[model samples]
Target: MTDTATDRSTDPQKAPSTPPQGGQGVMARIRSYTPTLRVQRVLAMLLLIAQGGITVTGSIVRVTGSGLGCNTWPNCHDGSLVPVAGAAPMIQQIIEFGNRLLTFVVAAAALLVFIAMVKAGRRAELKTLAFVSGIGVIVQAVIGGMSVLLDLQWWAVAIHFLPSMILVWIAAILYTRIAQPDDGTATRQFPDLIRILAFVAAVCLAAVLVTGTMVTGSGPHSGDAGVGMEGRLEVDTRIMTYIHAAAMYIYLGFTLVVAFLLHRVKAGDAAKRTAWVLLAMIVVQWAIGLTQFYLGVPRWTVPAHIAMSSVVVAFSAFLYAHGRVREGGTGTSPTGSPVGDARLAASRA
Candidate 1:
């Protein structure tokens, strides 16, 4: 006999199974889980920190002369995912392999931030920033693998490092944007002249970084001991160092000008504070650069320099972001009216 509805409900074997929500299963669940703004901001902040942190680890691999510790790309010691016995010095293998492993950690952080942005229904700008960050991590990994396959060529290594800075820039912007309300209007915190100066400062910073890479390519650290001077850039280290130093001075000057303008314009306290912090970091970075020059680039200074570069980049991005803010519903209107009060008066009228 056919099972009746009551019998089916009572019989375990005959009971009708409930289909997954909307029949979309995991994807539906993922779509349903919305992250709070605070959670999203935390994820973004973590991504920013991870982007900066990996550069330090990469510097460790370079300074340790362990770039080719595993001696292969997409595998450690060839035909293996981890370090192989006697493939290289155990420490070198571990260092290089460990650095490679960190790529995943950074990528995981990027993924989490990306998911947070999407789940929170954040604005397009935030979404794009998160998306680019994830993509940037993958690009960095590919470039890293290519650098390994190319035997850690100077240019290849530079190519690998620069994207990381770009990713850091993106992550910084993402962190800044995540804190802004989705429904908000753009508010300029400073005058257009100051904004232009900030733009020039950013350009100078880019030059400083690019020239700095050139200096590195001409330096003693070729990422691997075996690489030596074979594939190193042919430029004279002294001349490249001078050029890098010049670019840095110009960047520092422009940053100082920006800070001056911020004070002159009586900008928001946050903008002024960011400008001050950026100025301080630039000074510290300049001192580190001088120490590297005078001390002949000590091994310990490489990572310190690299870490400070990341910090400087993040703060530079932050200072620029502070130039423009998104004014939310509760924020002041461009005409100096209280946003909520203006709406209230309009409604009353």
Candidate 2:
């Protein structure tokens, strides 16, 4: 006879068998774990911070002339994932190897945010951004390895920095995107003038960054002291610096004009606020650049300047994003209603 409810507990057959290792049960359990939007928001923030932060650490390695500390790619030293006991100065090895290790921290953070986005069934937009961020970390790692293999060539170093700026831009986009209500649609808040100026500002910012890297390539700091200045860009440091400064001045002018337009159109407070923040960042970054120059580009200023560059890029991206469709309105609307009442519920988290 079949077991009755009363007999179920007493019957060995009624007991669940041990789940198969790495079977459906395990996957089901994993799938059942969903993260709250608040938790996801925090994780997104961490990913954003890490993407920018790692650049600072990279600058540290460069400024300290430890770019080739391990002297190998995909390894700290031959056949080792970390610094070897007697290979090179311990300080150089430690700094270079430690910076490499940070890639894992960034990867882990991005993975967490990606998994959370998927588990929560977030919109495709959010998932796509998270996915790009996850992949960006891998791409950055590969480029870093390439930099090591290329002997820290100035152009290679510049290439490495470019991708990171792109990744930081992407991360900033993800941060703002995720800040919206979990299930809400999105729409634009600014008028056409604001959007157009924002685009111009972004273009100017890109120019500024590109020229800034060129200025770096011609400067004394060649990533590693031993890398030598043989392959450094042939451009005069003074000329490149002046060009970079000019580009920055133009960028500042565009940003200020955009800020004025943001107010002229009477855009949302969020848009206005972002404009002001971008302006502030621009001023601060400009000051840092000038100070670092006259003060003779101290090693300490390298990290600070690099860090501010990341901030400037992030905010430039942010201002551009604010001009686009915002957190909530028509989720599928490409050109969302500018005056739509929909707004992100991100403040809840």
Candidate 3:
């Protein structure tokens, strides 16, 4: 028996102990709650949908002459929390009220995105995007109020439209960053042709938006005298409409070209898919634009056109962001490096 019964010291050859099952379970719970790149991407998409809905509803408010239904910011007529008895009846009040409710929803969505960004600790790029989207909602709300207060002045309305487009772009970036494959083979070097194509597409998009604003300002939707004050298309309005149509055609061409190049480069499945989506949106948008023009801006077509434009801008921006990232780079990491090529290679191995 010797000293064995009294020996309390541990042996040098003792194997190391692993963490307990309960400890591992806690770690798994922590990971589940942590915001990941995929979660951020999903949040961004949700925010985009909200923004698009808001844009469409806002257009409905204008197109239906419901903009003035409330007659005040943050309140209805007579300072009542709800629409008064004489205040444009129930249907008008409901539509206008619904539009107001959406603004709050959009704001709430943006706040959630901001919180998620903080949780995704390592993805600085996504964090910045969420911050921008959050700030954009606030600015958009302010601009929107001003539009109503100013009687929907053309410039104020146009400014309000611009932010929605920016929000769409931010969402697209978030989408691309998360969806990009982690393979090390993505080329960092962008072809000059691709860069040129992106630049042209961006220019075309801006022109289309500006011309659209002009067209709206000139049309009945602007709450102004439509087309002519005296039986002829007002010189100013006519010119603007032509410019808008021209810009639409140019945008259509640019989008098709981008789709062609994207296919030519074989720029991964994600990029190709995005390009195709953009092309489809472009086609649909053109059809709506034409229909709106020929139909003299039918009530239904107005919101439809606005909604389609939102989608087109979002998809186009996705294509642009996907193209900008060096072929293999994740764009999610702090350094924008091709995140851990060795890990990807090891996974393949």
Candidate 4:
């Protein structure tokens, strides 16, 4: 009669109870509450991907300078959520409002993931992450609205971008954790030195992203030209750009150093491979950053830069994750090579 039962982790040894043959009510109710791990995992991944993808679209809105196309929050213009045709060009409305509409997609993904976690009796860690994701979307929506209300001020736009980066990072963590069993034991793959390097790499990446936002705020694209550019960051765009680039250099430097340490320590091939991918993403992102700057922050490159930013952050997070435990293959090569399992078994023996 009560749906409020919380402890739902299925017992491996419990025999299935047979319901009355003619009336299957009890069995039907029991079946409804069982959580399928596969479905929950898939939903978690989609939420992670969507979190990053929406950030890219948001950049489009800014680079194209349609940030205020709808000119108001909660409602598009004055009285309605939909855009008023006479208030702005149809394309502008579509671009800005489209970004807003996608917010719903983010909300839906986060909601579904949270529901899946609770219903499946996932670990408290996973449930908390999913719940945070849903809450984050709400907070993001409010910040987005504030940006519009404030006329897309440089600071507002910058604030808006920062959270997307954070959510992407969290989503990556969630994706990584979902692969593990609900049992809360920790198994580390990389040694201490490598772990320190990975942590440094992550810290540097955060600096790089913060500086990158400053660079964006000082750059030509104001998200909306109508918004007074007077409020833009006082720092010279060139100087901020250089600072951003320097932070990026540090991030890449640390990541490469980690890769080197991975090799020096003769770590597992999976760890080495993940380190390589992380380094590659950092280098490619740096290239895009340089290109965007030299090309005068062209519109097309803005989205590219944003997209790569997301990719680099996600990759760095995943690398850090692999350092903790082998993703999906617990104690096995992330690349699914049998050697990882062999090594793990050997170590245990």
> In angstroms, what RMSD does candidate 3 have relative to the true structure?
7.0
- In model 4, the runs with Cα more than 4 Å from the true position are 1-35, 326-349
Q: Write the per-residue lDDT of candidate 1 for residues 1-349, one digit (tens) a residue.
A: 7669889989999898885776587775555556666677778888889999999999999999999998888888667989988888899999999988898999999899877766555667887888899899998998999999999889999999888998998899888866776567889988898888998999999999999999999999998898888889999999999999999999999999999888887898988888889888888988998999999999999999999999999999998998888876554332222432333344345
**Comparing 1 and 2 on lDDT, the stronger one:** 1
TM-score of every candidate relative to the true structure: 0.87, 0.86, 0.77, 0.83
Candidate 3 per-residue lDDT over residues 104-207, each given as its tens digit: 88888777777765644424666677778888888887787777677667777788897788787776676566444433344432467876787698789988
Model 4: how far is 345 from its true place, Å? 30
List the candidates ranked by lDDT, beginning with the highest.
Answer: 1, 2, 4, 3
How well does candidate 4 score on lDDT at residue 93? Answer: 86
- What lDDT tens digits, residue by residue, belong to model 4 across residues 1-349? 6333332335434545555664486665544543355666688789888999999999998887788898988999999789887898778889999999999999999998887666555667878989999999999999999999988888888889889988988888888777666543567887987888889988988898899889888878888867657668878999988888888888888888888988887877876887888778777887887788778888999888888888888878878887776244344222122432333344345
Q: Any runs in candidate 1 off by more than 4 Å, and if so which?
A: 1-31, 330-349
On residues 178-234, what C-alpha lDDT tens digit does candidate 2 reach at each position?
A: 656544545777877777877887888889989988988888888787877967899
Cα RMSD of predicted structure 1: 7.3
Model 4 — TM-score against the truth?
A: 0.83
Higher-TM-score candidate of 3 and 4:
4
